[model samples]
Target: MRSKRIVILTEGHTNPITAKTAWAVLRYRGGDVVALFDTTQAGKTAGELMNVGGDIPIIGSLDEVAEPDALLIGIAPMGGKLPTEWKSIIVSAIERGMTIISGLHDFLSNDKDLVAAAEQHGVELVDIRKNNERDVSNRLDLREDCLRIHTVGHDCSIGKMVTSVELTNELKRQGQDAKFVATGQTGIMIEGDGCPVDCVVSDFVNGSIEKQILANQHHDILVIEGQASLAHPRYSAVTAGLLHGCLPHGMILVFEAGRKTVSGMPHIPLTPLPKLIQAYENLAALHMPSKVIGLAMNGRLLTPEQAEDERKRVQDETGLVVCDVFRDGSEPLAAAVMNLRAEIFGTPVAS
Candidate 1:
C-alpha cells in the first residue's frame, strides 16, 4: 500500500517552535509530503527553507492541492490552540475528503464543527494528543540491555530533537543499532509514534514514556528525544517527568548559543552550561549512574566566530565534546556517545 500524501499547514507563523512540527514531517516524513502551506515561506522550495524536505513545493493554501490524503496541522502555537483562521481551512480539507491529523492540545476530534465536517465528508479526524490516556498502563522500569541516551537541553528549542535525530542516524551509519524515542508533538509527528508528554496529564506522562521505552526494545541504543528545560517554569514538570520517565543511561546536554534566558522569558536568566549540565546529571544520578556524555549546541543563529567561541567555551566549562549539530554534523557528539558505549558495553562503533 502507498503511504498517505500529507501537506503541512504553517500559515503565517514560521518561528522555530511553530515551524518545528512541519520540520519533523520534512526531516523524517518527507516522502509523504505532497506540499507545504506556509504563506510566509510560500515561494521557496521545502528543501531550501526546512531542515529536511527535498524539492517539494510550498503552496500558500489548501486550494493549491488537488487532493491530499491528509492535512497535518503543523504548528504548535503559543498555547497549542488551533488558530481561529485554521478552522475554515480544516473544514475545507475535510470537505475535500482529506483526513485531518493534529497533535495540538485543542482536540480537533472533539470540536463539534470539525467532527461534523469529518463525518459529513466521510473523512477521519485524528487528534494524536487526545484519547491516549488508557494506552499508558504502567510506568515500566528502564531496561538493562538497551543504553538510553536522553538528550536534555538548557532551554526549549535548543536543538534536542535535531541532535537526537542526527546522532541516531550517525550511530546507525556506524552500524550501531540505534532508535529515536520521540517525546514532543513534532517528534511524534516525525516518528509517527511517541508519547506527547506535554499533552499527557501529569500523572500519566511518566507512564506514557515508560510504555514507549518498553515497546521499542529491539535496538542496541535508544536516543530518546528530550523535551523542555527543567529551567523553563511553564514546562519544567514535563521536562523533569520525561527526563526521569525514560531513566537514561547517559545524557547529551543541548544548548542554544547566546541564549541568556529561557527562550522568551528574559526575567529568568539561564544558568551557565556547566551548571545546567551538572543539574541534569545530578537529577539522572538519582535513578541511575547517569551523567551527560557530550554536548549539542544550536549555533545556526550565531556567527561562525561566535559559534566556535561558544563551543570552545562550553568544552572548557564541561570538559565534554561539543558539536554544532546543524553546521558541523553529529560526529563529534556521536563519538562521545560511542565512547560511553564502549566503556559500558566494551564495543567500538565503527567500520
Candidate 2:
C-alpha cells in the first residue's frame, strides 16, 4: 500500500498525554506525516513540542498544508468523543479531498455532515476503533511452538504499546520471526492491522484477542500490545480480558518511574510494583503459566541519570531484567524475552 501524506489534527492539546495518538503516529509513522495542526503550537516544530517528529511543521490550519492525502484526528480524549469545536476543521479537510482517519470511540462515519462531505469529495472516513469481530473465546489451545509475550502496564498510557512495538522490532532484528498483535487503536494504526479490543463488546474482548493470537501464531514470537493496567480501577476489565485471552507465556511489566497514583485519577494510589507483578502472574496462571520476564520503565519524566538509577533499583528489587525501552533500548528486554522462549521451548531461536 502507498503511504499517505498525512496531517494530524491535535488543535489546542499537543502534549504527550492528551495528544498521544499524534505522538505515536509521529514516533512510528513520522515519514508519512506532513504536518501537525495545533493552533497553540503552530509555528513550532513537532520535535520542539513533543521531541519526536523531527522538524515536522506544526500548522495552524488545513490551509497551511499543501494537498495532504489525509487528516488524522490525533487526540483520543476522555470518552473518546469527537470534540464539537473541531467539526468544522474535519469538514474542511473532507471537502479538500483528504481522507479522514479517526481513532475515537465516536465514529466519524456516523456524523451526517462529515459523511456527506466525504461522499461529496469521494474520500474515505477511516475509523480505526470500529470493531466487527463477533467470535466468542473458543478456549482453543494456542501454538506451543510460538512464544507469546504480552506487555502489561501499571497505569494507563505508561508505554505498554511502545514497549511491545520496540520489543517486536528488536526480536525481528535478532532474526526471530516476530509479529506485533496490536490491541488498541493507536497500535492498530501503526501496525495497519489489529483488533481494537477495547472497543469490542465486553463479552467479546477475550474472543477478539484470541482471534488475533490464533491468526498470528505462524510467527516465532508474538508481542501483544497491551491496554489499561491490570491494577487500574476503572479499566481493569480490558486488561483482565487481554490476560485471559492471550494467555501469554511471558509478560513485560511496564511502569512509569515515580508514579504514585493511577494516571488521570490522583485520588487512587498505585499498586506497588511487586504486588502488580504478582497480580498479573496470578491472573495469567488461571489459564496458563506465565511470568513477567522483564520490566519496561517509562522514564520520560526523569533525567537520564535518574532513569538509570531507577532501572538498577527496580532490577535489584524485582530480580527481573529492567530497561527504559524508549530511553535506553529494547536489547535487555528482548534478550529476556528470547531467554523465556528458550526456557519454554528448550531450543534457541534461529538467527
Local accuracy of candidate 2 as per-residue lDDT tens digits, 85-113: 89998988888888889999999988999
* RMSD, one per candidate, in order: 2.4, 1.2
Q: Estimate each model's TM-score.
A: 0.92, 0.97
- Cα displacement (angstroms), candidate 2, residue 197, comes to 0.8
**lDDT, model 1, position 165:** 89
Which portions of model 1 miss their true places by more than 4 Å?
1-3, 15-17, 39-44, 47-54, 134-142, 348-351
Please state the error at residue 106 of candidate 1 in Å.
0.8
Write out the backbone clash pairs for model 1: none
**What TM-score does candidate 2 get on C-alpha atoms?**
0.97
lDDT of 1 by residue, 1-351 (tens): 233689888787644455788877777778888988877777777777665676788887777776688888877776788989888888878888888888889899879999988888999888877745555445345566788889998988778988998899999898888999988777877776787888888887777788888888677899999888877877888888888778888899888888888777889898787778878878877877898888898897799999999899988888888889889999987888877878888875445
> Where is the poorest 10-residue window by lDDT in model 2?
342-351
* Residue clash pairs of candidate 2: none
Which ranges of candidate 2 are over 4 A from the true structure? Answer: 1-3
Using lDDT as the measure, the top candidate is 2
Q: Best by TM-score, which number?
A: 2
Candidate 1 colliding pairs, count:
0
